[model samples]
Target: MADTDDVINTGDLFQDPDGFYEPEKEPTFAEHRMRSGDTVRGDLLWNAGRTSAHYIEERAAELIQGKDVLEIGAAAGVPSVVSAIKGARVTVMTDYPDPDLVDNMRFNAGLSAAMIPANSTLHVDGYKWGNSVEPLLAYLPPNSAGFDVLIMADVVYSHREHPNLIKTMQQTLKKTREAVALVIFTPYEPWLLPKTEKFFPLAEENGFQVTKMFEKLMDAVLFENDQGDEKLRRTVFGYEIRWAEDQLK
Candidate 1:
């Protein structure tokens, strides 16, 4: 909704009655799959790669113990839910205009909020990354506890929104600035790497540092194309970024 080509209103899945999303019937890739029989495919319901949240959740559990957490661009919110499951004090899953992820996330809240019992919070809001700070800020009510950590995956799909992505984090993140704030990116292509580097100056301009926070390349395997070709590999890059703690103040 923030006018980005990479943006998809995954909330459309809710326009229909059933929660089931029938992603395009194509083979999934090995890296994106949790089980051998499964693959990352898109449907009217969920978007690409279902298992990345598990990794993000696992990683967050290590770094974010007893800290409030936020995952921007959380398509399905499984990672956020898993963070809650991991006993985080607070965790928020945010995305663009599409509330479909939040809709299902609400169900997750109902199912396990009592068991986890951490200060778990979830929301659906539009974040245009470096576009504007107001949109992302509007989601956090006044006197909110803010976030101690942030998480992301597969968000660097487009080279255009990189600036907004960096700026948005620099603006919206309340905690974990400077050497603490972190953003992770999944690999897209050889071209995407250089485009991401151009934002380093932008990060410095905002009084933050854009380090290669984290990188985890999963197994590569052939998957189907729209035309049913199996020549492509599951191309994804898992990454992270750290910000200075002073930026929030």
Candidate 2:
């Protein structure tokens, strides 16, 4: 037998490991074309987000220009950036506090820096829904009531978070009748459309009024092979939520 010192430490070399290590995944991104002719990239650019940005530029320019605007669940912050370009007084873009997600949002914001107007300021923050709005509120001008507009894009798919979404809206939306929260989403899972639709009624119960704005059909479904009604998946639904008449008082 060989001496112990000469023995190689190759014990269990032939044995299969209990688990295999996977290499860290490199992040992937999708490119989006803004109405201003600039291109932005994100992990994935949901059609609802693109549509919301378009709506802001075309239909809601009056609401965004020179107003305090906040975007929750802002994946790439396209709408917030567009709002800044449109001359919003303050545009705050927020998403869950994941390093990768937040960093990507900041990157996109930086890319569009030159396009943003001198009078408008754009900020980025990591925020979770239903959390304290104070941090977000801090970005507003001194003595300001609250944001004039809130952008919610492609967020209602999570059926469980409806209440939390509404809570954030209540906390941050200004009480004035002109203040509005834009909730836009696509029913990716067609079967769950009813659950997604429940958000509007719940918002009404929470002292808000919901108005259906428009239904847009995109050129293609975001996920072509997704198991759902192709038409529903390609369609983007938009709504405006405002303080109920009583709440505005």
Which candidate wins on TM-score?
2
Q: Stretches of candidate 2 above 4 Å error? A: 1-28
lDDT of 1 by residue, 1-249 (tens): 133323322333213334322342332222233232322222111222344455544465565556666677765555565566566666666666555645644554454455454355545454545455564455555665456667665565444555556555655566444224444443333333555455455455555655653344446432222322112224344334555445546
Candidate models: Cα lDDT each: 0.49, 0.82
lDDT, candidate 2, 111-138, per-residue tens:
8899887999999999998777899999
Each prediction's RMSD to truth: 9.5, 14.6
What are the TM-scores, per candidate, against the unseen true structure? 0.60, 0.86
Residue 139 C-alpha lDDT in model 2: 100
Worst 10 residues of 2 by lDDT: 1-10
Clashes of each: 25, 0
